[model samples]
Target: MSGQAQSPAKPPPELSTSDASGTVSAVAGTLNGLPEDPQMTPLAPPRSTPPSKIPLRPRKIQKLSSDNLKPSMTNLSASAPKPPSSKKNRADARRSSSDALAVVIPRVAARSLSCEGEVETALRHLCAVDPLLVPLIEVHPPPNFDTFHSPFLALTKSILYQQLAYKAGTSIYSRFVALCGGEHGVVPEAVLSLNPQQLRQIGISGRKASYLHDLARKYQNGILSDSSIVNMDDKSLFTMLTMVNGIGSWSVHMFMIFSLHRPDVLPINDLGVRKGVQMLYGLEELPKPSQMDHLCEKWRPYRSVASWYLWRLSEAKGGPSGVASAMAATGVSVQHHQHQLQQPLPPPTEEQQQQLVDPINSILNLGYSEFHFSS
Candidate 1:
């Protein structure tokens, strides 16, 4: 207790003991709650006395076998049970399926006028729908398509006849046939064999020779064939034919009605048809081509027959000025032209005939003239 401040006494060292009976030794100091020596290592609290009843080892994860993974019979019966469909739903599904099929399938060609009894059927239908046509139908013999020519020959003749007078067209066609050896030899190969010079020598203009060559080339290339032409639908045939150099929509209409004998074709652009419609209905001005479809809507399915009658009607003895007089005999009233009846309509000149029958020729001629001038 002097001013030197003496240190406190240290604790006694731990005493260790061993037993000969093989029991664990104990450290007396540690049992008495003395701190362990700093230099000595400590024992981990006797590894949490593992439960005497060992904890069940977690079960191992295993993949399920396919047999065990299969759906139960009860589940199969419960899942995807089809709801009952009404008749309307079934019909709608069928209709939609048919519509889808129609999109992929090409249209079948319709029966032509040449089919047996078709003319008679058309005549009866026309008479029933249009009383004004009865007289014309009776006056003119029914059209016969039995003499239909091969598509190549017919097309060749059409090209030759375009815009020419009857005599001139006939002369050119005769010469052309002779050049090809005969009508029987007017195949695509024979036509293609003829040079432009030879065609020109036969009185064919350079433009016409070019048109013929184009048609022949298309045929030779298999772009067109007689069988395909015969089997094609009217619209398909028309579209394909007009792809030829000189064949126009007007020519296609004429070919469809006369050559192919299509049952339902109306020459909406034909001057004769327009004039006939005007006279038949007694209109002051000619009917526009745009209005033809509506005005002649009643002539569907038998429009080709009606058109034939119109051609005859327009060229009948009295003509435009005397439609009233001529139609009066047929019991068709044309009161609009009653006053003009006394004035005879002069016979159509060659130019007028070409205009009415082959208007495309005139347009081609105009084009040819411009081409000539430009050249």
Candidate 2:
């Protein structure tokens, strides 16, 4: 390489000027004692060339843009896509919702006139807590003015169903009806003439047997006739019915609704009702009676209707639902459902068959047995 000396002073103007010639001239000019124009010079020999990166393997590019492809709603590491919550993604949602409103509008129009305001407020609260429950309750109504009838036997049947499931209770009740006069099972004389020991023998638990007898005695004695219960307020009536043995607050609530047909009764203590609430609320723990009561307070006079809706919701529940499976994704055990009764009674045996066929009334001297159905 030809060595070019670094200039210590500015080049003269003639030397600094570029002429038509292409030759590059190095010269020196000075400011004070220092060079004004810096001449370009080589410092040190060049280092080796920059190392090239290993060429990347070419990837296939997707031709479709985002709009052409279904949008993914999953977490980065997860393969499963979540449900879309976007409005555009939910196009049919508005139509389904409006049709739902159409169904709801007529129902509100058809509600009990006196309790309309309370029903509105309570249902508003209920829908807020559980959007699904509203439609169920709207379709299924609870006991009301038209459902109740004044009779000992009808009310007794409803009480027998207490804490029992719909199907089991229906089966047991059918057997009980056949035991009682069947079709004509509930007259004053039919129950008054029933042998307490005989009724107890027909699969009626000891406590329930006593309850029936006490109820029979009171009805016969005029202590609590149909009128007496109908006129009594909710609290008084519940207390009066609960006075009977084996009949807890639950039974009394049933009696009030099905028999007395009282409005505003809340069966907060019922396991089914509470289970429904727990399921709807998606709770980790089942709520206590106090918590159920506090939550149910908004239901007020329409609590029975709210309860019916909740029961319907409970019926609609699937085992280990999507939410449950999601919760289980974290490897936690989530109790999916709660059964009302343990080890349900088995279907038909000789004892049950005999009880069903037995006479409601006895011969003049003996209790209801040894009597056969007339052809």
Candidate 3:
């Protein structure tokens, strides 16, 4: 080994400007020392080749004839979309939809006391709920609804009887029925066919004649019908009936109870009912019409029978005299008094007349006979 440290070895040569210009050549020269300048030599022109000697063939063209141009009916029918359904088809579809709905949603049979054993059932229910009603129920015979009259006839009779005494109303009703030919002929058509003069001749007032015509027109227009009225719920029937010119809530209540024999009806506007309720419950003041529903809630599903007892209670207290005093005390008009008197009641028999002076005593002494309510 040398006495002094050997000198550091030299590094390998790096690419410089001269090497890039191809002026210097080394064993590791790039691109074999070729010049990078484009002007160094001109490139040779591309050689041209001669076109091929083979000839091209042309495609043959053909023209379409009239027969080929014409559209095919079978193809058109198969490709075209169908037209919209006709009116008859739409109507049939609606009918089918209605039938399907009818099957899915069953019709509710109307609740009525006129049905067999309904009054008996109602009386049992009232007796069970209210002990006080037992005495009254025991004394009074169950109301009979066997005399089912047509809704139109009942409604017409009720209108004629409004604000009139029973004897006078009965006389007018007889004449009105005769004009229509008979009770069976008292239809909407017959009522509408009668002129105002004809109605006036039968003792119907001008206002009342207008009311009757309005009712008949409603029936003709499909707004009201016997079946519709019979099948309607109490609230809906009240709303519908009150739309007539002269029919009020009081009239509707009477018709529902006496004619339709609906069980849950409580005539709140009725003076007799109010008096009876007051007497039965011993209230300091008469119940407001609005309060009647809440007070009579327990008698539900048989309030009609309970109301019948109340009428009897009112009658037993003082007959028409007590009712008249109540009307006067309440500031009720003469018209209202007449309206109260027009409510359906069986004419007082000789025994009933005697019992009127002391109804409770009479009921306990001589029990009621078979009495049926009708309009």
Candidate 4:
């Protein structure tokens, strides 16, 4: 056996199962003796502890007194986290809130002169006050005064129409408006920009151009303004506008009645108004301008409306104006004028004929040939 030289040295024999188990236990004990790695350590299940009772104590929550006080930013981040929101959702929320506010608010509001109920009330008042006006009211549809023209613009147009026939005045006004940019563009600056020669070129006379310039300068100087004109009382307005070169009391009255739709203007100087008065009362001669205020006392507070009917009366052929004829047409009995139409009335004087064209010089006293306009 010693000579088995060539045979490799005998190797250690393999361990038995019992011996291997003991060796594995020794290795495991060596591993337990070493320090445990924190990351590599397996977590143990949480241990169940016995419940403890907390003693109740009452305390008031401290309230923040200052409006400027804010919660801590650190607490905000640490508290329950919210899921991210999209921009569209935030916009939708804002839009819904705005829509709710819109529904809660009102849309239409009452506006000046927009109340038709006022018109009905005025009509009822008129019918109750004057029996003659009742027929007129029933025969005609109610007057619809929806338009409110700027006083400045109306004054400008009235300036162009002064002392001229309707057609001639209209043509001149169109040309004048063209010179300035348009009707809407007829402001003080535009009128002032054009010289007397330029205005004359547009069919405005030299005198009328001077008048327009004077009006423009007054506006530029702040002595007269749209607001001032509109706010002025009737007497004060008559005085102020008459100070302008071409504007007169007659023109002011006409403007107040037609342009401003003033409720109680009586154009005593107006020829048509006088003629209407003559026919309404069946007078032998036209009533003097001085007597007009006394004769038409019943038409107060609605004199402008009465004046409108009066103008229609002069154009009518027979009866107590057209309004009475309208009453007769509606089955109401009209007390006809008992005065017979004998000889044809003499032609009106040259002064009276001039009144047909001249607005300012139309006021006349009975038997007086000429009358001057006073502010």
Whole-model lDDT values for every prediction: 0.69, 0.51, 0.68, 0.62
Lowest-lDDT window of 10 residues in candidate 2? 357-366
Give the runs in model 1 whose Cα sits over 4 Å from its true position: 1-110, 317-345, 349-351, 358-375
For candidate 3, write residues 3-90 as lDDT tens digits.
8999899997875654544433333244577444533333343467897776477666788899888999889989996443798877
Tens digit of lDDT per residue, candidate 2, span 1-375?
248876679766573223312123222223245443344442343478989887698677879877767656454338665454797657667777888898877322223312335445556666775566766656544212333234466556644544443345556556677877683566565765667576666655566666677777777877776666656778887787777665567656655543443446677665556767887778888788889878776555566657755644544452111211122221233233223212322343343222111111000001111122121
Per-candidate total of colliding backbone pairs: 0, 8, 0, 0
**Each prediction's TM-score against the native?**
0.59, 0.46, 0.57, 0.55
* Sort order, lDDT high to low: 1, 3, 4, 2
Candidate 2's TM-score reads 0.46
Best by TM-score: 1
Collision count of model 1: 0
> 1-375 in candidate 1: lDDT tens per residue?
588768878887554432311122225446778654544444433445656875589778898999888889887778875543888877888898899999998632336776788888888888988888887787766654444466677677778877665457667878999998998898888988988899998889888988898999998898988778777877899899999999888877766766666789988887778888998899999899999999998877789889867866775644422212223322334453343233445765664555453323212111000111110
lDDT of 2 at 202: 62
- Please report, as a residue range, the 10-residue window in candidate 1 with the lowest summed lDDT: 366-375
